[model samples]
Target: MKTLLLAESHPPTLEHLTGLLSQAGYTVRAVSDAVMALEHFSADNPDVVVLGVDLPRVDGQHVVHLIRGHSQG
Candidate 1:
């Protein structure tokens, strides 16, 4: 199964998106913040990642930068 790391700060949107991705056959690992997102990114090494721009503490772009810094990806 394909794995997806979903970083969504809003609960309703998170649930809805998770459901949609799950229905489409993705094994989703949902997180509410950039910190958790990065942690999961390292631990899970998911094939896909969906991050919310309005995430708390840190934004999605920075998270992407951090992820890229951690790998050639």
Candidate 2:
């Protein structure tokens, strides 16, 4: 089974997306904050990540950079 890391700040969007992904058979981890999202990404090492551009603490672009950096190092 594939894993998905979902970083969405809005509650409704998060719920909706989570439901859809779960129904599709992906193991999903949903987070409202970018920090938690990154933490989960490191721990889960998800096959795919769905991020909201507007996020708290850290934004989506920065998170992508972080992921890239971590992958390289």
What RMSD value applies to candidate 2?
0.7
> What are the candidates' C-alpha RMSDs?
1.1, 0.7
Checking candidate 2 for backbone clashes, the offending pairs are: none
TM-score of each: 0.96, 0.95
Tens-digit lDDT string for candidate 1 (1-73): 9999999999999999999999999999999999999999999999999999988999999999999999884
Off by over 4 Å in 2: none
Q: In model 1, which range of ten residues has the least summed lDDT?
A: 64-73
Q: Give the TM-score of candidate 2.
A: 0.95
Cα lDDT of all candidates, in order?
Answer: 0.96, 0.95
The 10 consecutive residues of candidate 2 with the worst lDDT sum are: 37-46
Model 1, position 16, has a per-residue lDDT of 98
Clashes of each: 0, 0
lDDT of 2 at 31: 97
